[model samples]
Target: MTEQSAPGTDRLSSVATAARILREFGKHSTQLGVSQLARRVGVNKSTTHRIIWTLVDEGLLERVEETGLFRLTTTMRSLGASAETAQRLHEAATTPLDELRRYTAGTLHVAILDGTDVLYVERREGPGAIPVFRSVGSRNAAHATSTGKVLLAFLPAERQARLVEGMRLSPKTSRTITSRPEFLAELQRVRRQGYAENRGESEPGMCSVAAPIRDPLGQVVASVSVAEQVESVDAGLRHLVAPIVETAARISSGLGWNR
Candidate 1:
């Protein structure tokens, strides 16, 4: 019992020390030596070495091979940006999504991609609209939704390849793109068109149109979609993709996206 508990305690202590090191980096400049980090975290150099190397191996911190100092990598910035972007997206999208709800008289959603899944972060339903089968904090396959396509379509090519290299594109409906080559083609078209559409692909009687939400850096960080029962969408409204796209642009601009 003592041996088992001792290891757990040590692991917890190491974790706490690692967190302190990261915090110290944030408090000061980005670059710091291991010795500086150890002193800042109030730990001895050996323990600091263990913690720093662990974080380095995990890509949370990167070691400058020449300077032998550490700095936060793009991976770290990307993670932080993703969280901040999500918070800002939620705040900026609420009013716009509400307005979209009034315009479409349907369900609306804001989503982000988490690995191969679309994670719904916000949702609204119009009065008298059919209840969507999704909600905040729910996740579904990225291949099955317009929101997911908008998110996936803007991913860097290498990242996209990494995600779908060996993925099994399962069919959610007969209209779902189940072949990798076909899905890739679809994503290309979505990227060119600046939006994505799902016509009974995710749900048999449901249709959705989505546009990408970009951040200040012009990175696609989220998506907004208007969904409705296929029969309920007016034919004229189906051609009015501008409203949804414009609403997404409004939210993106609120998040500091220029142009």
Candidate 2:
């Protein structure tokens, strides 16, 4: 038996709900009330109430004191700065991605972390590239993708724990790491090795490797990945390591990461 505690399903469920509630704010210009947030996110009012208060406690939101509405705090504004970074990250990765595509003849992707998911911001298919059923705006669970694992492995420990624990780790394939301990261990390996790999974890027959892209502050902000369809999970992985790492380093340097 796994003895992992239903993998804390509700813990992550609530987290995902909180994320949805927060995103609803982006669609509006003013402060929002619990009822409106509930209606928009399709959650009951009471649950939305708790989630908002939790966000308030976390300092991402602030209560209006008199009107009982909630507004984003300065903390959120600081976090929102990443949106600009995302644009720059896209620009930074473009030339590197083009080079990687020509060099590897595989599908290349660049992604940014968004809550528990890795949002694909750019995708390119080289000659003989494998078809990965995702696009510029599509998203995938971080636990399942090489790009997502790279992002997760580089996150601050406390925030990483919160996110990894909250994730359900549902199996996407026979090799998916559905156990939290196992997944954490894998992340450790990824961090130590400075890259991450997917051996048909996200989809059968698809294998990928990714490396982290860091900003000027040396914080990892995105990942560059290349994937191919292979007969075995291990096929070509050894050769991919250096080239993918080189590609990521180039992209990171373009973003002003010195190391």
Candidate 3:
């Protein structure tokens, strides 16, 4: 009788094997041979060969034709670059965001556009911070927040359309923009004004103002937002716009946004 793995066991084992192979590659500063890699990971030569070939096929590793050695590929370099960019964005935004939080006595956030949501990368709160709920690494719907609006507003129209196409508009508050046409117009206004404002749209008592953080290419890569209670914001929206825009601009400058 032949032994059989419980359902999904083979797939899980393969995944573990692949992960081990990738980890072993990281331990080396140079290309690794199949036998050497197998010895390091304590896997059979054939299993190591299979995992290495799979990784190479997936662009995670590259094989040297002359030496038959395998090494990490440019894919890892791209991943590193992405991580560095996020880290730089967080580091660069910290001081300015803190100052803005202090100035406004509210919460400040630095967020990146992730698909149809906003990914909070950094956050600062002052003594007068309101009771809104969000944290670093939190994700919020892109249609319901100031940061999300600025990010979506700066996107190319076709791209924006694709993101909203056939998507159900979920309502978070009575003030949230639900219709596609109305939301599109809101994005238009946000693009023209170079900022976005949320007024009791995300949460009943909360408001936020946000401006885009641009890259050296003039592409919006992240956003800076100031969030406070609605009562605290209604009277000061106009005054708040200038400083928020300025803060985002300064952060963008730090990120190499010249224009």
Clashes of 3: 0
Highest lDDT among the candidates is held by which one?
2
Local error of candidate 1 at residue 209 (angstroms): 0.9
Better of 1 and 2 by lDDT: 2
Write model 2 residue lDDT over 159-236, tens digit each, in one string. Answer: 999999899899999988999999999999999999999999988888889999988998998998888887888563
- TM-scores for candidates 1 onward, in order: 0.78, 0.70, 0.75
Estimate every model's Cα lDDT from 0 to 1: 0.82, 0.86, 0.84
> Per-residue lDDT for 218 in model 2?
86
lDDT of 1 by residue, 59-138 (tens): 89998889889988887877776777678888999888877754778778889998899988888865545444457888
Candidate 1: residue 93 Cα off by (Å): 1.6
Higher-ranked by TM-score: 2 or 3 = 3
lDDT of 1 at 255: 89
